[model samples]
Target chain A: MAEHDALTRERILEAAEDVLRRFGPQKANVVDVARALGVSHGSVYRHFASKADLREAVVRRWLEGVSAPLKAIVAEEGPAPQRLKRWLDALVTTKRSKRVSPDKELFAAYRALFDESGIAIETHVGELARQAAAIIEDGIARGEFRPVDPDETARALLDATTRFHNPAHAEEWSDPGIDASYEAVWRLVVAGLTV
Target chain B: MAEHDALTRERILEAAEDVLRRFGPQKANVVDVARALGVSHGSVYRHFASKADLREAVVRRWLEGVSAPLKAIVAEEGPAPQRLKRWLDALVTTKRSKRVSPDKELFAAYRALFDESGIAIETHVGELARQAAAIIEDGIARGEFRPVDPDETARALLDATTRFHNPAHAEEWSDPGIDASYEAVWRLVVAGLTV
Candidate 1:
């Protein structure tokens, strides 16, 4: 019964994603999701307490997908500088791809939901910062980085790179010189981190 | 007659600003602006080509107000590092003030207009980058900073500090530890700039 319930929840989330992509957040609703899944809205509510709860769950799942690869990078054994640079580059690539065609419309659909899913976003940001802090701590231990507070330095790195990954600047990501711009910022960031 | 025309244009802009502030961008229109000025909508159109033009002009005026002080900072004869730090601090303070009460409602109204005024925003951002570049060039000339490409470095600096000044991150500006966060980033930036 527990396995059946878990499968049902996964199916519901898939349906919700499709419904959101087809109709967008403004028009998408639990009824549409349930209709897509050939189930009653009541059944949808049984798995997810409310429409907002379902939307938050969908966003959380998507954020988890974004974080999974970064987690692997953090857990890998490497010189911290290379790992950190690779991590930042991967982040920029992932964010830019989401802002482009194919995923762009789906991302747009979720972005509205994101505005309402504050808890989900906060959790995602906190987790990302923690991962960055782990890298910084390792770098410090290896004498590759300055003896700065790892958490604070990690937060600073994220904030400094906000333009590269933040959705608000998504439109600017396509500019031809954007990669060079990111490189310039990365050079400065590396200089700051090195002992 | 030229002076009279200029005065009339100024009066129309003032009325337009009031109308936008009172009704917001969604509801505000040239008709409302004309009503505020006790003139026909045609009179407003005579000074401004269309609603978009009028909105762009309003945003340009506000942006000019924001840039004027920074221009003064750039023109000041001082150590480049101190001037740059002071300029960044002033920008953060100005952006924060606009996000707070009194100006906050007006800023919200204009923010919608700003979205449509891409040319105005781009020009404003370009001008700001130029101002920062001038300071960086001065620093390099004085042996205060490493010989980096001034324009590119300036752009990187702006991008790195975006969270402090960009409207999208206004909510984070009010965090109690935000100043410390900015200081941390600034220290890194200074390290990057200094030889």
Candidate 2:
């Protein structure tokens, strides 16, 4: 029974993500999500007390997916500079993907989520900053990157990459167009940090 | 008479920007703008055919303000590397002002403008591309920059700068803080384009 309940909840969350991505946060109500899932609204309500609950869940899911790859890439075997460069490319590619279908909804939904008052996005933002900072600091320590303030370097890279990740700038993204730009970003990181 | 007409147009555009920045695009109607100006809605309409027209004028005004500094920086006597760095910093600063404004309305208005259809943003984007390309080419010619495709470099720089300019990514805007991240941007630009 618990297993079935978990499956139902997962299904409902998936349906909600679809609705939020397609229609936006304002229209991603219980009725719309239920309609998308072909399930009763009660099913959604059972898993989530309200629309806000569901929205938060979706955000958590997105953060997990995005951070997973970065963590793996950092752990992979390669020179620090190469790893850093690939990481930059991966960041841009992920951001570009968010500009495409289905993910656009996630992007929009996250925008709305960020705007909600009392929502502690600081925790999430800090986590991201910490992860990025660790990578640069490690690279610097290994002599694969230039030595600079790890926190500052991490923050700069995050700002550059996150700006590219924005949906409003969606029109500007193109494949292979930003490769050199990404290289520039990695070089900047290395330059500023290199001992 | 022409001068007066031009002045009125400028006043109306300024008023529109003020209203949009204060009340957002949806609320920056002719009625509100006229009221703000202590004039009649007819006067507002005289300068602009509709709210959309007013909004366009406001955007044009904003773009002009942004471009003015860039043009000046480009024209200033300096190596391409130094001028380009300053130009990138200027671009980031201009973008940061809009993103970090306490005026939620202005931010939303900008978002609405991005959503506008049939709006010939191509001219604006093209002009930016040209100006940036010219700067890069000049740098290359002067031996201050590496020999890369100037046009491609400009497009990449503009695209990346445009990403930071977006209001949606406002959260990350100050995380690394605008100034340092921009330094990182310039470093990357120089690294990729420098001979």
Candidate 3:
């Protein structure tokens, strides 16, 4: 049992990630994860109550990998508008890379897990939107952007720019003229916010 | 064959729409449409050629219903900028009203047909984008909006506002705050395009 063995739990998670990567989320099982780490499947259950829980943890880890950097960007010292632009650029690039250029298999895995791990994903989106809201709030305080409810603006921004950054729109993101599309969206955002 | 009688062909299509509406894309076959119209199934085939063709025609008719009003708006006498706003506002309203109000059943039916009627849907999207481009081209020529390529800007605009009008995002659009979200998006579009 991993009840008191935190290291064993972490190791199992690492092994689970590897097994999932190798076999994919749909085909990968807890027994396969345990086999990857040379442990019985019972110990895996000691750490994660069920297969669904393990999938949720892996998806949480992947989503955290994305939002953590944005949270840091929100905290960084800079002009709010510029920081917002940089943050959005980072979000787009990271999403595109995850979804298309480098690791589509993992992205595909995440997409499948997202529906299964609904609460984990819902929480992650809330955190990211809050980060956007924080940046908007900062911009308004500095008198650089228009006065609007930061939370509403954040949702609007996310919803409006969904195609540019959403994984579901990955195919369109790779179109020959996608850069122009991104620029047009950013121009609109900046124009709308500038005092 | 009903081909020689234009009125009969129209009557068959009207009955097909009714059958598709009632039984939906999956259950509504050509035979069902013919049964609804009290005609021989062969007559339905004479008009549509195949079940796929019948579905495509139904989807094309549905999509045309959405865009025909916009085409008129594009041709109406007005300043380009004002017309553009009117066009977008009209788009959001029509899309929302169709998606949410009395005909949600039909919207669901269309979503089902959209998958089955891919070419029809693709052609419909291209036509809508061209309509947007025509409005943008007029605005650019009138010197009311920025000097951007009408076609690219039209794609960008459609991409940006997709969530508000796209069927995939219909659930989110029903959120209580959707009106505010639509207003925020319009503000950005108008601000970004103003000379």
Best by DockQ: 1
Q: Give per-residue CA lDDT, model 3, range B1-195, as digits (tens).
A: 353454376677777777766776675578888888776788778778888777777778778889999999999877887888888888888888887645777788888888767678668778888998898888888888878777777877787788888887787786787787788777777767777
Q: All candidates' lDDT scores?
A: 0.86, 0.68, 0.79
Ranking by DockQ: 1, 3, 2
DockQ of predicted model 1: 0.69
Candidate 1 lDDT over residue span B46-65, tens digit each = 88888778887889888988
Error of 2 at B25 (Å): 4.6
Candidate 2 overall lDDT versus native: 0.68
Q: How does the DockQ of candidate 3 come out?
A: 0.51
For model 2, residues A76-108, the per-residue Cα lDDT tens digits are: 775676677666677667767875775666776
Error of 1 at B189 (Å): 2.0
- Writing each residue's lDDT as its tens digit, candidate 3 over A1-109 gives 4633653766777777777666788755788887887677887787799888888888888888898888889988878999999899888888887876346777887
Residue A53 shift from truth in candidate 2, angstroms = 6.7
Docking quality of model 1: it rates as medium
**Which ten residues in a row are the worst by lDDT in model 1 chain B?**
B1-10
